[model samples]
Target: MAQCVTAFKSMLQARLLEEKLASLYRAGGRIVGGVYIGKGQEAFSAGLAVHLEKGKDVYGPLIRDQAGRLAFGEPLLDTFRTYLGVITGPMRGRDGNVHRGRPREGMPAMISHLGSLLSVVNGMLFARRLQGRLGDSVGATSLGEGGTSTGAFHEALNQAAIEKLPVIIAIANNQFSYSTPNSRQFACGDLLDRARGYGVQGYAVDGTDLTACVSVFSEAVKRARAGGGPQLVVGSLLRLSGHGEHDDSSYIPDQVKSSPLGQDCLPYAESQLKASDLITDEEVRKWKDEFLMEIDAALAQASKEPTPDPFRENWRALSTAGLVEGQFEA
Candidate 1:
């Protein structure tokens, strides 16, 4: 009951923050680069993140992983600071929103190229193996359904299987990659079948259901931790918002987008909670208010962070320790 409440709290906070970012972007706030929301996939990411051992297991979170990242201790204020280009924030306002991670803390920042995340995480897992600490480490990463078709995804998965690395490859099969739907992406009935070809275990999950996602991810993480090798997990969900705030996501079908069952993960979880009698309306309202207040305070503080100083920022972007005198001039 406690874990379920925490999971719901994480999801609610993630959803609210993403919506806040969208609102800020629309209102011409300090947001730079793109604004992507993990609104519909909150349960999936949060489920996987909560199962991993914080200081021991490593994972790379994509843009749609705000909840998971937050659950792992990424500051909500830092998230806002990254987008607002605050000098006092992580990335020193250098890396843009959600493109940052704390490697020392086991969260490798994700690259914009979604397909590359798998290989990067696999390498980290491989490094642990080389150090003979493989038993102590497990890795997880995410990609969209479209990314599975990329060469990097196949190569990484193939290598992980052959090496018997403890890595979990999570694919968010939201049926569409940006404007392109699954039909145009691949002919395969399910992405999980690719796991068989690679000789690893695979699980297809209903990403919206927090209980199911958390259970599956927990099992996979435990198996990997026990030296059972890598697992491929595919999550099927809907992209409630656009690929970015700039996009209206009009390409998605109206019926699918409008369907509460398909569009929102929160309500699904709420229904489950209600059915189980695990929560009351008053409790839910209290939790919601708490998260909103927390977020409001974080954002308020984040907004006060000033932009980086141009002169001080230039040297910060590139270290001068090993550079030649002439190189510094440029």
Candidate 2:
């Protein structure tokens, strides 16, 4: 019950923050890059992240994973800083807003290529195993169903299976890959089939159901940590908004939008929490108010911070002087 409440709170906070980001982007001069929000997918994203142990477990969140990032211990201020291009953000304002991460803290800075994050997490877990520091620590990464079609996803899953690494590959089957539908992406009957083909344990859940997401993800994490090799969890839902703030998502049909999977998870999650006696309407309202204030303060502070000054910045690929040229080859 406590875990559910916490996850719900993270989802709520993420929704609020993303809404603010979208507004800022619409205002025409705030954000540096695209604004991507995990609208209908927050429950699934937060569910997996809430089970991860910060500093012990690793997570690589995708572009639409603000909820997961927060549940995995990312600061709310950092989101604003990154989007506003404040130099003090995790990316030091050098990268896109969605690409911010702290590698030393187990979250790798994201690359825009689809399916690439799985390999990155696999490498991190493999490195830890080689160092004899793995010790039941699991690494997890999230991607869309479309990413599953990439070669990187196949190679990483195969590597993890061969190595028996403890990892979770979360797939948000949101029905469409941007404007493209699933029918065009793969011929498999279900995504779980891909897991079976890879010889990894697989689970399916309703992405719109917060309780179901939490339950399934908890079990998946447990299995992975217990030496069950990689776990693939595919959650079915719909992307409630456009791919980014720029696109209007007119490509999505009305019948599809009205489907049960298309329903927004946020309200459903709140209702579940209330009915379970874990939270009340008053409490939910209070949380929203508090989150709004925090977001306002974060944005205000980040807006006043200076962006990176190119004149004072080091543009070299290697920042350390000792690593230069042939001096270190010996």
Candidate 3:
């Protein structure tokens, strides 16, 4: 294994953990006020995204919230621009929210179906093969553990196994998928364990454990890169908060919320490093203050910026394209 820098990784992890704390302040003002801040689950998204970017990988997000997207590579302004209906918003503010990630140039536009993106994964692989780019291309899809019970999951695994397409399907099993407890959705205690039956490697990790998450995803990415076919990782991330904007996550607890995995990314990474004497507590506090100040400045800047004109030139350009008449559609 290559000697990867741990200090920056720790800092990066800390920056991510800052979500739980900061989101609390902005949740009420956010689109779906009180967004599901996956406190302890930050590492899963980070690790998975880091791995996928090893190649020109495509992220097929399925309503798994925007944390993963932001961590994966979506710009900060693009994220906030989403609320303002700005063209800079991913997809020009069209398509669904949550999985509303920008396309990687030639990648397919994101679909809103729950687990249906699996078919797109297969199709993408097929198209790449036709173009003699199969080995050079790869697909990555993400879904909640809840979506695993759906038929799409089986179809994806079976097809990928039979065809030997390169893909990395990450299941962010954030304990509870919305209001429904995971137990109600499946009989399997661990979803990753099912990967072996489909003729691919499967593994589970403590999604909160950033180091472990990084190592696991790194290995999976290496395998996929070497054309070992697709792999499945069931990230057992603790949902320290509620399922979404509506329900109270009384099923979990505030105590669970205290840990790095349960609260958010930045602090977890900070605390972990601090515990291991990787960085000083003062340095952690400085980093937190710096990030918060940056956020405050960004929000303040956003407050002063002019709202985009609904009838701006791009809007007019769209109107002239017979978009309302559906000229672009097949």
Candidate 4:
């Protein structure tokens, strides 16, 4: 009961923060890039990641994954610092967006290329096994439904299954790949079917139902950790916001956009919490209010930090210093 409450609170905080960031981006705040939000998909991230070992099991999160990052122990201030490009933040004023991550916290930095993540995560899992560190350890990575069609995704999943690597591949089947709906993406009966075809354990869940998401994801994670080989969990949700703050999601059908399932994850989670007698309406309200206030303060403090100047910091990123100085040319 206590763990459920804590997980719900973390998911709530991440959802509120994503909404706040969207508001700031629309108001012309100093967000250096697109603000991708995980508004309706918080449960999959928080639930799947909260139980993993902090520094042992690495998980790569996509742009729309604030909840995953927070669940893995990222500081709220660090997230704001990353988005706002604070000079002292994790990325050190480099890429100012969800594309950044802090691996020291068990969260691997995600590349923007969606289909490519599975391959990288597979390699990481293999490396862990080689180092004899695979005792109940698992690595995870995610991609949108559209990503399943990519050749790299196929290669990664097949290889992972063949090697019997401990990895969890989450498919956030949010109905659309940006503006493109599932109909255009593939003709597979479902993503789980595709996963099964890859010769790995596969399951699908209602992404909006917080309890269900957590249960299925937890099962998949446990299976992977037990050397049961790779498992794929596909979560069904909607993209409540635009692909970015700039692109309005008017492309989504009105029927889907207005459905109860299309609503944000908060109400669904609240209903479950209430049904389980885990929380009260008053407590839910308090959590939202407190989280908003906390984010506001964090953002205000982060905004006061100096903006990163590339001239000063870009030099630090140059890995081939000796080669650049012509010392290695000969």
**Which prediction has the highest lDDT against the true structure?**
2
- Residue 229's C-alpha lDDT in candidate 2? 97
- Which portions of model 1 miss their true places by more than 4 Å? 258-263, 316-320, 324-330
lDDT of 3 by residue, 1-330 (tens): 111123234235334433533454356553433344445555676666655552367766555434455445555555445444345556454432344555544234455456778778777776878888766556777778877877877887888888877777888877676757677888876686679778888978877666676788788877877788888988776665555546567876556455543645445655766676767867656755765666566545544555556566354335456565545655
TM-score of each predicted structure versus truth = 0.93, 0.97, 0.77, 0.93
Answer with 2 or 4, whichever has the higher lDDT: 2
Q: Tens digit of lDDT per residue, candidate 2, span 282-325?
A: 99999999999999999999899999999977665686756876
Candidate 4 stretches with Cα past 4 Å from truth are 314-320, 326-330
Candidate 1 per-residue C-alpha lDDT over 1-330 given as tens digits, one digit per residue, 9 for 90 to 100: 555656777888898888889989998846877888898999888888877777788889887898888776677887888888788776777788878877777878787776787777888888878888767578988888888888888888898898898888778888889899898999988898888989999999999888888889888988888888889899988888889999988898888776653757887788888789887788889988988898899889988878888786545334664464545553
Steric collisions counted per model = 0, 0, 9, 0
Stretch of 10 with least lDDT, candidate 1:
313-322
lDDT (Cα) of model 3: 0.61
Off by over 4 Å in 2: 322-330
Best by TM-score: 2
Model 4 alpha-carbon miss at residue 130, Å: 0.9
Q: lDDT for every model?
A: 0.83, 0.91, 0.61, 0.82
lDDT score, residue 233, model 2? Answer: 97
By TM-score, is 1 or 3 better?
A: 1
